[model samples]
Target: MDDLVINNLSNKGIRTGKQYLEGLRDDRNVWIHGRKVQDVTNENGLKSCAHTLANFIDRQHEPKYINHLTYLDDDGDRCALAFKTPKSKEDIKDRGKSYYEWAKWSNGYFGRTPDYKNASLMSFASASTFLEKGIKGQGGKVMAQNMVNYYNYVRKNDKVLTHTLVNPTYNHQQGYKGKFSEKVALQVIKETDAGIIVNGARLLATLGPLADEIEVFPSTVLKATPDNIPFAFAFALPIATKGLRLICRDSYDLGKSHFDAPLSSRYEEMDAVIIFDNVLVPWERIFMYGEPELCNPAFSATNAVVHMMHQVACLKLAKSEFMVGLMTSIVKASGRDKDLYTKGLIAEVMQMTESIRALLFSAEEQAHEDQFGNYIPLRYPLETSRNLYPRMYPRMVEILQLLGASSLMATPSEADFANEISEDVEKYFQLSNLDSKNRVAMFRLAHDVAISGFGSRQALYERYFFGPPALMASSYYDLYNKDELMERIDSLLSE
Candidate 1:
């Protein structure tokens, strides 16, 4: 966008849901189902998610939720709670509580809550000085200030952001090693007085169509060689930026009623492949430019990932608890709550849920001051939660399927209850305790969570939320403080 737009951001503490939707009527090119969507707020498969997020935005203005989701800044400006510079342990706990509150809005179904990116931006901005250090002392002071400016700008306007990191992989082997091909990877192809011109495609920008802007950051560790410099920059642009096109996966909503596809109806946040076709990223928007040494450690050095994990930890807790609730409802409706096998399956979910809850609490209780002077939840516990929840979520889904059994498949559509065969459906579909309508409704929700396309995608999303399970495990192993544990083993042997 031009300087006029950047410099004229709205100072409104929080925007209404209608205002948020209206702002999305920009020039963003979003395609789905072999057609370019003209308006996400009105599109059949995309509208529900658009308005769901709008409600999330509007919740910031709600009296009951406002205190949890927002806070007054030093200048007395009411900024999003995610943007608050967390300075103490209490701040960490408060943030965690707020994250849980937001997650409950969708029973943890809406994975890409705006607060997720907001947390990342807040962490980076709070530690803006690290960006000032540039790789090998390259000119980074300006970029540091740019980040500070962008953070304040977004917080003031309450802008919704989606971010892209990974580039499309034509070859699995090369891609796994963080290799980028010029034919497909987004990179700087030319430089102008105004900014750098980027072209090529990136994989997996979630919430791309509905977001106000997109943050295109480094995808992975860069080699820092002259050859790799072009691909090492970080920047943000309005989603409506000219030449930026988003090709989204087929939407899962498909206009299903809330009763028929409860989760899908409310939480099909779009994922897309972003193609930056000679897109110009202004100098003011560049957070990192040709600095692999700095870019590689950007998230870690600034403790941004730790704070990000804190947010994810709470989300996982919400999700896990939601699964437990779903399972309980399933068993109770079938009068199988007293069955030992049924109890065994659900108990496992409860155990897993409690483990996640404990890990989140441990991280918060162990909060410490980082070098950036901001308080961050402890990494190991949060890291463990991040690494473990992916594995846990799928197993929980499996347990749900096991417990749900025939009832999951025996579900009747909401339409069936009003049809001529309504009498047959009412008599046959009734569970031990639940009548036809409520039973069908419960199982439909269960189907949406376990058997439907929406449910399957959720499993896939969690499995790779932090990239490949092997990579996450390897990173976890490397980051573990194994030296102390090894010493303990050594002392035992010596003894």
Candidate 2:
């Protein structure tokens, strides 16, 4: 691991599945079933899927991503992930180009990669640099430490990380005092010099098993009543940390073969219910606690939204582009390309996806500097994507399913294609002069995106990813300068 070569690997994210697993096993806090998991590295249900994602990270080290996605650090002694944010309008547009460069490789499948976590951590790191002298906010120093550790760790080892912010369930009606409160929320039970003891759980720990660490934070605005202090905490724990368990949802890939579940098995983003049983967060790892007002705002004040918006919008747009291309290809192959109805359907999908791409790109190009001096994507455009994509993506997926038609539903199992019934299955289902394997591959992709349990989960993920539309709309309303808009409207009316 010489400086130059290590730097090269860091640029490309060259870590392996074995390295990632070892990292997860390295004193991480993770549990499953009734016992603490000692070997998530090779857990039957989790191993292969985790490894598949690790391979994606490994690819970053390859020549393809080494150039655009990796860059020399200011010191020139280290290499860093290459992404741009705009301090000016021109830079903002350039940032959008950078986002597209990264997104194209994923075709949107790998939206929440370790790079995404890095983006958030970098924002935290940048913001923490402005901490007022002689005053350390609750958990803020811990957050700074975690960010530094993560960046250093990733730079040296090329490992990827993922995190979960929200508790598993939503109980909007229940305040902290309600009996149903703790049942749906994760809260602190005790405090210690080593760290706070958290007892309860978090949800949507996407990629939890694969990540080297799980950074935990509240997903919503926290109110600091005496009872709610524990809920307003932030910390990072190794995935294997004691008393932490990740209860995975029912697997969607089980119903279909790998060929048919193309994205489901590897692209599942395997979200989980993370239960913490008095789990200890070392002082170094804690980011916030006992400050409800600061918790939500602290997260909001950073460049997190800008970074996240670029990642998802770019990835989703790429995916939509692929889908549009795929549907067109399918239509051409099926001899329905000229059909008025089919053309109209595809036109609508194209319009939606392209519009999303345009807005996402505009947001990136329109980025601006925050008070902390890091670049942030423009608020309105990113907010619009955050609002529309959740609704739009499902529809895009639905149209893909519709275009797939009987092909998506009636595909023969891989077993059947390999068995005594192979001839019959092939003759009946294979389409457009393509062989069984190619056609099956297309159908499998469609199943994963549209018909399978993966499809259902994706729909749910989009609907609640940035909170419900109401909450999102409220954020937009709050952040937007209504007074300026009102003044402009008044002037127009006077005219």
- For all candidates in order, the CA lDDT equals 0.86, 0.66
Q: What is the lDDT of residue 190 in candidate 2?
A: 84
Show model 2 residue runs off by greater than 4 Å: 1-14, 25-38, 74-102, 129-159, 168-170, 175-180, 255-257, 432-436, 488-495
User: Mind giving the per-residue lDDT tens digits that candidate 1 earns over 266-355?
Assistant: 999888999999998888899999877778778788887888888888888889888888889878887899999889989999999999
Instruction: Report the poorest 10 consecutive residues by lDDT, candidate 1.
Output: 1-10
lDDT string for model 2 (377-441, tens) is 77788778888888788887888877887788876667887899988887876667566677777
Candidate 2, overall lDDT? 0.66
Which candidate number has the best TM-score? 1
User: Which regions of candidate 1 deviate over 4 angstroms?
Assistant: 3-5, 492-495
Model 1 residue pairs with clashes: none
The CA lDDT at 319 in model 1 is: 90
Highest lDDT: give the candidate number.
1
